[model samples]
Target: MIIQKEISLKPKSRGFHLITSEIYNHLPELKEIKTGIAHIFIKHTSASLTINENADPTVRSDMETYFNKLVPENATYFEHTLEGKDDMTSHIKNTIIGSSLIIPITNGKFNLGTWQGIYLCEHRNYGGTRKIIITILGER
Candidate 1:
């Protein structure tokens, strides 16, 4: 069986946020799936999705710092600055991170590592509520 759902996340500041619980909250159908793959896709270009350390908040903050240094805004060569200084950089960060994640579902739960969690990499200053499409393919 294949179940697809779209969920809108609350607005968040520009940084990496652990959203594993949020995803599970919106995807109750995951509890019904015995074995399958969950595909989580974010419907935005200025943001991204990834999996990383979930235990330490400092890791998230450090990620933001490193990414900012790596892809600083106002590169002078960016032409897509109509939105703001973060426009081009956000898009670039999105590209570097990604737009979706594929995780295995086992025993009605995500088969994530002990310290691994899903992250919503909000690259823009005001990205607003983000939309995520969750596609679950599996059998009961």
Candidate 2:
């Protein structure tokens, strides 16, 4: 059996937004199924999906800082400023980060590391809603 769901995320800043619970909620529907892997995919170009720390807020903050340093906005060489300085950089950030993620689900539970979590990294500067596609595959 295969299951799919969508989750919406509202990011305040241009950074990672944890979305484990939303993904977890979709897993319960697959309880009757024997066992399979859960694949979480994000449908967007300027944003990305990633698996990161869930324990500490500092981890997220640090990552946010890291992205800033890695892809600083308003670089002199950037000319695609029609949407603002962060436009091209945001797209670049997404390209490197990626657009989808896959996670394993065992015994009807997500097989994640102790501190691991699934996050939707919004590379955009402004806040908006992002959609995530969750797909669960298993045997009924």
Candidate 3:
């Protein structure tokens, strides 16, 4: 069976947010698939999707800090400044983190580690609702 759906996430501030529950909550069809793969693709350039530590909020904070330092805004070399100071940096951060994720689904649930979860890396100061396309493929 193959299922495809587009989910819109709520607006979030600039930071790494755990969104594993939100994804599952929107996809009730996942329960029908005993073995499959969930391919989640973010439909934006300023944000990204990644799997990371879900157990601690500090991990998310540290991630934001690290990335901010890694890709500082208002740099003299940034040419894409029409949007805002964070425009170019957001793109860079998205590139580093990526825009998609593929995870195994076993026995109707995501095959994620105990401390792992899906993260919506919002790189802009006010990244509005993000859209994601979820494509599930496998056998029931």
Candidate 4:
């Protein structure tokens, strides 16, 4: 079976946010799947999706710091400055990190590691609601 839906996330500040519970809460259909794959694709170029340490808020902060350092805003080479200092860097971060994630599902739960969880990397200072397309493929 294949199920697909678009989920709109609440607005978030510029940071890495753990969204595992939110995803599960939005997709109740996942409970019906005995085994499957959940493919989440972000609709914007300024944000990204990834899986990482879920237990520590510091990890998220560190990730944000690292990305900011790695992709500094208003670089001399950037020409897309009309949007804002963060616009181009946000796109760069999104490209480097990624725009989607595919995870294994078993018994109606994500098969993530003990410390792993899904994250929504909001790269803009005022990134409005983000949209994600979730595609679940499985066999009951």
**Predicted candidate 2 versus true structure: per-residue lDDT over 17-94, tens digit per residue:** 787886666556766656788776777777888888998888888988898898888479888767887788888888
Clashes of each: 0, 0, 0, 0
The sequence of per-residue lDDT tens digits that candidate 1 reaches over residues 17-108 is: 99999999988878999999999999999999999999989999999999999998957889999999999999999999999999999989
lDDT of 3 by residue, 1-140 (tens): 99999999999999999999999999998998999999999999999999999998999999999999999895789999788999999999999999999999999999999999999999999889999999999789
The whole-model lDDT of each prediction reads: 0.95, 0.78, 0.95, 0.95
Candidate 1's TM-score reads 0.98
Model 2 error, position 5 (Å): 2.3
Scored against the true structure, residue 37 in model 1 reaches a CA lDDT of 99
Residue 76 alpha-carbon offset, candidate 4, angstroms: 2.0
Q: Using Cα atoms with residue i matched to residue i, what is each candidate's TM-score against the true structure? A: 0.98, 0.88, 0.98, 0.98
lDDT per residue (tens digit) for residues 1-140 in model 4:
99999999999999999999999999998989999999999999999999999998999999999999999884789998778999999999999999999999999989999999999999999999999999999988
For candidate 1, the per-residue lDDT at 35 reads 98
lDDT over C-alpha atoms for residue 85 of model 2 = 78
**Candidate 2, position 31, lDDT:** 62
User: Arrange candidates by TM-score, highest first: which order?
Assistant: 3, 1, 4, 2
Model 1: lDDT to the true structure: 0.95
Candidate that beats the other on lDDT, 1 or 4, i.e. the better one? 1
